[model samples]
Target: MTETKTIQKTFWQKYSTLMISLVVLVIYGWALTGLTFSGIQESAGEVSSSIFHGLTHPDWAYVYDGSGEDLVSLILQTLAIAFLGTVISAVLSVPFAFWAARGKNEGKLHPRSTTGKFMLVLIRTFPEIVLAIMFIKAVGPGSFAGVLAVSIHSIGMLGKLFSEALENMDHGADEAIYAAGGTATDVLTLATIPTIMPEFLSYTLYRFEIAVRSASILGMVGAGGIGTPLLFAIQTRSWDRVGIILLGIIIMVTAIDWLSGMLRKKLV
Candidate 1:
């Protein structure tokens, strides 16, 4: 009876993986059946040629001539928007993080955390483009609208990141403080804040890199950035201008990513 039972368990184990694999394959097949493919356009070749010609002969004049609509100026403005948005979002994420990652909920279900987690999901799910349009309508189109959109959109991601950091944090210092009859303020200043600040800073720096890219895109909708001029160039069929703007954005984003990486390493 023992040998029979052992053989039966082994047989199930051997087939379970195959069964799961078959199910996954079926799901993928079903999903793929719903996809629709579009054919290439007749003007695709001409459009591609124009784009390549522009890239090969980028408008060097657009870099800077103090027109204020130049690539350099617009790129700088985009960076500023990203920086402001990142800082504001980092600050706002703190309370959300703490609320979602409460120590008391460890190893157990907590409705407060569930609700907070759901709220974060909702925040994240709200599209940044939509937020930008709303802000533009509310405060008129400009860099300020972009800043608000980026900051608010960033909260969901940053809050989730910060909460994970908090959950993984070393609670030993917190306990040590409590055992020594330390005040809550003492625990916060001595243990809680210090224990998590570095990680928080690191995450903020990482998020800043994403913010920079987002800021550039937000400008497309008149939130103000390099995107404004880029869109204008596209609409006007001035492909060279678009090429220069794209180059500038690439250089700026690459530089910021490198700098953010260095800062994150230091903080970590």
Candidate 2:
């Protein structure tokens, strides 16, 4: 009986916090439900049926349009934004990563490391939309704003990932290089970079994939891409054009995902 009581006490001790959290979440969810309308709008069924009809009958012309401002061209613009953003961000992240990484000259305890982390946090605090808006105001709307926003946001992510990769590297090579009187640059090129290259490439490719999606969405804010046209179609109730644009987006994203997946698998 004593042992049974001890087990019961231990179970309650282990689960008490979790139970309390669940109770809080349940109460919050119940409160939210009260704010929802109890009935659907009368036009809901009509709107749904119209959307279904539009999706079923997408505009084939838009799908294959090559007239400079067509779906294909817009998609290509989005691709460019994603590609350039990833490249710029990857290049910019190198110094930040080296600074923030533990056990380097600017390791975690160093002032430079703290500064690097602070910069990364500041960059990451704002969403891409906010960054895009700022860039739009600074440079005017177009793919330029989208590219800058993606690059800035990606720097924060790539910096953190790159730093972790560097920190996790085998330090024995670095130690050996240092013992052999190799300079910092020599050690980095011969020991550090070689060890972390695969991870770095992997992270870059992953960021590129994310940038593609972000580029598409950035167009909604007039940053220039298929998203702008898609939004226009929705606003104009041009269901056929929306369907075509959606298809193009789906195809583009899928192709990138497949390509990136294969490359990542090879790296791993």
Q: List residue ranges in candidate 2 displaced over 4 A.
A: 1-9, 13-21, 30-34, 104-110
Candidate 2, residues 84-169, lDDT tens digits: the string is 99999999999999877777444346777777788888888989889999999999999999999999999999999998898788
What are the clash counts of all predictions, listed in order?
Answer: 0, 0
lDDT minimum window of 10 residues, candidate 2:
100-109
- Weakest 10 consecutive residues of candidate 1 by summed lDDT: 102-111
| Candidate 1 segments exceeding 4 Å error | 1-25, 35-38, 104-107
Best by lDDT: 1
lDDT of each: 0.91, 0.90
Colliding pairs, model 1: none
**True-structure RMSD for candidate 2:** 3.0
Q: What is the lDDT, from 0 to 100, of the residue 77 in candidate 1?
A: 96
Model 1 TM-score, 2 decimals: 0.90
